[model samples]
Target chain A: MKRVKFGTSAAVLAFLAASPALAASDVCKGSDINILMETVPDTDALQAVKGDFEKEYGAKVNIEAVNYSLMHEKLVPSLTASTSSYDVLIVDSYWVGEFKTAGWIKDLDALIARDKVDTSLYFPALMALNGTVQGKTYMLPFWQYAMGILYRKDIVDDPAFQAAYKEQFKRDWRMPATLEEFAEVVKWAGKYKDMYGIAMAAQRADPVVMEATNYLFAEGGDFYDRTTWKPTMDTPEAAKAVTVYADLINSAAQPGALGANFDDVANTLKQGKAIFAISYLFLFPTLEDPKDSTVVGKMGFAPVPGKDSFLGAWGWAVPSNAKNPDCSWEFLKWVESKDVAYKRALAGGQPTQMWIYNDPEFIKKWPAMSQVGTALEHSKGLPIMSRSTQLVETFAEVMGSVLANNVPPATALADSQDKFGRLVKGDPLLK
Target chain B: MTTATIRAGSPGRRRNLAQYVFVAPAVIVLALVVAAPLLYSIYLSFQEYIITYGMGDFAGFANYLAVLSDDFAHVSWVTLKLTLLCVVFEFVIAFGLALLLNQPHLPGRSFYLIVLMIPVLMTPVAVALMFRLMFNPSLGIVNWVIGLLGIPPQGWFGDPSLALGTVVFVDVWHETSLMLLMLYAGLKAMPGEPVEAARIDGASRLQILRYVTWPLMKPVIMVTLMIRMIAALKSYDLIYMLTQGGPGKATETISFYAYRLGFRFLDIGQAAAVSFILLIVVTLLTLVLLRTMREN
Candidate 1:
């Protein structure tokens, strides 16, 4: 009995000695965490500043980056396991619903409250689209890609071309304000022998879906009726959007547009083979890189030619089965802090915070960022649900058919709408 | 019974137990790695197993019915076309090359053999990427070269009418080398007596090839075709890296469709059902080939 009492007292003393370290943020010290990340500029910026975090917390961070096409499929197996191989997951905006519904990612409300994270600092669209689902925060906004028009300033700004444009259209040449005007501009630009008009990424699966969604939004159409939970892709507006998108590809886009993805579009613009591209703002730096781009200083940026644009963004989340949840949370807090956000923005990564966009340094460095900031205010994100993958893939296939096989937009979309409706109906959350 | 006989019987029983003990690990490993997962997948095919939400209600044949009602017919047709085209073309090219390389007095045989083996040695994904770049409509060397002849630039992998043919061309390039090596090896292992007899009887080279060499090489040819056909049926990597089954699903095969269902769409039950259907098709083809082999 005496021996047992002495052992108990010793254990109590040991616990007391370790209490402070366990409670402190330094609890991340010596912890090793792994993150699944997408191959994007934001991830590059994170890698650049990783040594600072490692030194500050005495911890190790391992990031595995994969191309966007493979990111979701790669994450699924790991996330579904009882103990995830990844401590942190790079959550795309559309994945929020599925992740939250599956309980694969931890709810960050308590953690945010504990850390006093200023969630309001992030763009409301990013916050709503990327991390927050049904009033619960599950992720921290990492980076955002606002869709916009990138063009050759030299070609558009030339006096001779402007004069020719004025004569042809009987109006002064300016940035297009509507989809019809955009198509006319694209068609006019295609008249040059040396240049194609637009570099479109129209590959079947995700590329075309992303590019087509802009048209869908600008034309006042959506993938589905939110309130009724019915597919809206077969509407007249949706058909018109698809027809315009397909017409652009057939008449104005660079050769092999049907097989091109975002990278291909970037390359086409960089090679000076195309005059403009409907591209994500995240690709701006890549276009400006002197080593790869032939049209580095010749390019200009503007918002898409309509009120609505597609918003692309990613967020960081701690997986529910993370072995080092505290360390993961610590990493998220540090990465999403104002200082880091500023650093990331300066490193040519897209900023998720409103403050970063308004910073004087950023405003001076990237005049185009103001346009991006304005675009973000009105941009729309793809509908988020557990069945978004099916929705996007089905729509992508339909767009592909319209572009590749010359199927009428109405017929293809009608078929897709019927198929996608059945797929969505199977979603338990919807039911 | 005699005491000696009883002792001998005891030793025989002990020997049998020792054999089982030695084989037990392999059996257990096979059961764990191969049989267990396969059985589980088959079982899951009968249940509504969503990846996000764990296992749900018993689905019976609904998953199969659902998959069949989807893109099964189109993908099957594509897979069949791809397999037949690849196997037939690969056989013709590989057999011709094998014949040429089999000559005893052929010049630079070793150099030619090494050159032919390079594609076989290459990884499929790397080959696909290399070909994708080379076939890029705007920037690729292929279009540039064809331009010199005044032929209009073709959207090789981007055009729906051309995408499947382009994939088959790339597949043939990457796969025919392996077939060549196999056929060449078979030719080398062939008996010389029949050919010598045919030549002595005034049989022309073509006649000898048709009658003697063809008959002797029948079994090897069947096995090689069977192997190549099975591989063609399971083709996915090249399709993924080259075109991603794109241009309006023009090149999508059964294997890719199954992958899209499971990984991209996260419909595990339906994906499993598709895989089981593919397994059935492959099994039927393999049985037919085996039966042909037995008859031969």
Candidate 2:
């Protein structure tokens, strides 16, 4: 019934909410709720609207932003010690099972029932895979994402390079339409001595594995068999994917690609030093920012040239030890409302609702953003299990062995299969 | 094995309740700060305490056994190597610098000493970040310097072969100043009579340093080694920031390995076992140092 579009007239924002809902709840009206969020565009948008939220809800919302790598280190201790420090947490999809199984997160069904919230607003895949464990909702998918290819339009549109590429390949050079074509662009662009054709977050950590999963998906394999929860990394297709991914780093990628992560890869794109990058769809805003980016307005976005890619999500949940859960729920319900989702989208944070993509005004500025919806239909998140994060460690180890030690992909995959199999099977909770 | 002497005018053959009262707070603080965590870790080591999965089964020595196998062995071996390399290199360079700075003719000597200790004065996290930027293969000054010296481009933290050595180099750079300060103080505090006697007997400078200076500085050397080794064993912030134990776990010492297991993997039981193992090893090493240290 109401809307909060970014470019709308200022009078609309003032009149959007007929009555403030949070003011009715005494506990939420004056209480302070602390939110632990990853340092990302979402946090930035949240900060931008802090005064608005405080004024509307009549509560103090303290946001403690931290690097994504350190969230587990901070979150675990508080949950384990039962310290009611953080009322809300921005958690990765991979952590859903762990948090739910450990009883660290409060089941959200209670709040959903009380508020009569429409749970169908999120992408069903994200909701099912990220927010629900054993049919109980723990978190709401806040900023859902899938991997895409980000490349330099100005560089590829150069007359000389395009002419040369057309002459060499017998086709007009354009945005890559397939994985092979993408590789060709990388190799061709890499030939210039001063520039690297592609940048990859091949660092032997979560980033590398995240990128490599795209390869595995494109190759028609996965990290594990879905129904059995058994590792399939040693399968021929997955092994081939691992080899190609590693070889791409060894050859066409930037010199220090083996040690780079998503931030480095994004900066590589921003600096105009690389022609291509593969990461979350949310990377577009940073690349478009004129303040920090050199390649603003000179980039193109596409669904990853492969048939599939990672469909990751970061969700918001109330920790079981949350001191102000009523306040947290009051905030969560307000934020997930359709108007707020649209508002978040306009303010540079990603909105999880499927309908936001079809907004005519929003589409005028970001027509390419809708392609991600199609990509999400094909992509899959990491294996759903309490020990899924452990698999990230194994992937890093296996990929590192290939990149750093020259271990054959098949051998490395076999090793990982054994390790990950033990991890999934050996855990009593997983059983 | 040691004789006790009563102070002149002290009350004889009576327990000093006031002395216990004076020490009680310190004892309480030590128990809370050090002993409590140690006891908790021991208790956790025997359980399957995966924090995310809630209460655990009584795992007995299974968690401890897990720590003894697989990656733990590699982690322990790396810790030992790093401890030896860091302690040895820091001591040699620090002792050399101490002797050099102790020379009476050196101009601006105090200024140089203060400048040298800057690394130690800064926090390890800041130092690690600075070094991480420096170690960047393409853009970092470290590789730039190498290229200028007619050497080819090199990966510092990014190379599996060179990564451990690179962290070791950073440790020595940040810590050698502390060692230098300790040995310099020791050199100044040494008995002047023994050096004078050695000088009068026509001993060479090298001979005096070998026979007289080193033997007399054993107590200080023992202290330096104890503090440095313990710190090196517990080193985390530096490696965590710089490489996150990468180019494939090259610099993943025992402490980082345990942290990864506990925090990252959520396997607190095995992590506790690793911590207890490190505790035992450090205790034995400290006892060895004490045994040799008391001989003087």
Candidate 3:
């Protein structure tokens, strides 16, 4: 080890101090690590950063990216096998509950403490919701997502429409802040020739469930009672949520809302058709894309009008059977660090840090930072449970019945209860 | 020399040994690929097999009992209807087109046949997505063309009442080509002498088609029907890419239901039980077809 004395050598030391990944490379040794992630912007950003990390710590990284739908199929065999294939795994937040119960993940609290990593730098709510399972930090927060109401600011900002809106509703025209106001906007804007009130995924699939969950929570309803491990989707408020979801889909949303996903909703906004939509934060970047969007610099986002919006985020965890656990931690620490996360955010990745949300630099770049912060604070992540995945699908079918057919919301929810009850029967997990 | 001295058995034994030698590799491959998973599935059907938890509790007959429900009935009925509907329409259209192409001295027949058979070349997922975009109520070409006659924009797959039918239409669009190729080939192989003789004896085209052509086309139609029915029963890609058995399970067939159970629900035991039921249904269908052939 050599000591540098001032000036030119000091300049090199200052640059090294700026990059946490480069500085931390000396603390840990290197080996080969295979990482698993869904094919999303997070995967792209990680791949882009792979070269830098490999050079910093002499580790070869093999990244396996799969479509989101097939992630479970790809992960199950690897996790259940006697030997782990992937050293690092990115887990959808909902699966964290069961993963924790299975004891297939390494507890990272000691690692963070030893490395003196400041975990509080990340969003507190998401860190609590996604990373902590059973009061233990098993995963590090990566890309965070929250449901929001993205609106056509250009259209709403027009004086003609604003005057007409005020005359019709006896109030100022603005983005909706509550479910009633959301429905009213849907009805009010639906009569226009060019714009629909909202864009939604109301079909008989996963999209409907994702959209409806926000409504369920906004109305102060929930899917399960944690103490009893029982479903609660058939409650009066839940039933009302279903009805509202259906009514909005039928009268206020875009014509193809039935089978449309978030991509479609964002695309509709980009094409200058829809006035508003409730979707994840990833939709924001596409709206800013110059080549694809017709509504560039013309859209805005707000916290969805509800008690709370829906939240989803994926995080990196070291499999208990990791072949190179130390190298995996080194890569994970580098990716989740302040400098790398900031860089990743600039390159089409959603940053997970609390400072990134409040930073003056990012707030200037991101138009909806304040509203995003509010949404994150109010948002609720999907339930962490043994059968959480199926519960989502089951509720979707129930809600689909409400929207697609003329099934009464109450009846459809009851039918859903029946179906889910059959699933929960004789389950060891629930017991 | 030692092999020759080993056992000179009867001709029956020698023939049996020869048969075993020829069939052993195929049997071994089948056991490894097909029979192994099937046997494991049967074993798994009796246990609560969570992928995360490995093999869990053994609840005999519980999985089988759990799988028997109204959901199963609804899915099976949807499968039955879709299979029957697609097979009927595909056969009728394919047979009609085959007859038209089978005409004497048709110009550019090869070119027409090649053009008509394009759908089967593309993947089912691609075909389903193409139709999904085509039927998009906002900007689909379908509504644009139909709007010329003042028809309102139809929901197509989004309408619970019309979703299954719309799905069948997509399936027909992509799959009718297969039926046509098969039927056309069969038409060429059929004897023309009977039809020629009937025409010379003053029988009309309709009469010749009904009596002469119908009898000869039965076997071909049956084979085509079997192929189409089996394919329809196992249909997943189009439904997954289009409606996902949605708009309220209108297009939810047994195969999709079983997949949702296994993959989505993580109910491996119940999923295996559902698959076993489908296997039985297919076996019964095959038996009935074979019996019909024997009787006919």
Best by lDDT: 1
Instruction: Quote the TM-score that chain A achieves in each candidate.
Output: 0.93, 0.90, 0.88
Worst 10 residues of 1 chain A by lDDT: A1-10
| Candidate 2 lDDT tens digits, B96-145 | 99888877689999899899889889999888888878877656898789
Off by over 4 Å in 1: A1-18, A22-25, A426-431, B1-8
lDDT, candidate 1, B196-285, per-residue tens? 999999999999999999999998899899989999999999999988898888899999999998998788899999999899888998
Q: For residues A336-422, what per-residue lDDT tens digits would candidate 1 score against the true structure?
A: 888988888888888888887778898777667788767887688987788777778888889877887789999998988777787
In model 1, how large is the Cα lDDT of residue B46? 93
Task: State the lDDT of candidate 3 residue by residue for A175-263, as single tens digits.
Answer: 77778778887778767535678878776556787888888888888876656757786799888777788888888777667767666
Question: DockQ of each candidate's interface versus the true one?
Answer: 0.67, 0.51, 0.46
Interface RMSD score of each model: 1.5, 1.8, 2.2
Clashes of each: 0, 1, 1
Q: Which predicted model would earn the best DockQ?
A: 1
lDDT, candidate 2, A1-431, per-residue tens: 01332223224223333346424344567778887888788788778776766888778889998877888788878877645588787779887777777777777885687568888888898898767877888888899767888777787779988888888789987777767677777887778535777888877578888898888887778877877777898899888788778777877786667777788788778878788777877887888888989988898777776667777898888776666666677788877788877877877777788888889877766655778687788888887687878878888888888888899999988877778877776554455
Q: Candidate 1 vs candidate 3: which has greater TM-score?
A: 1
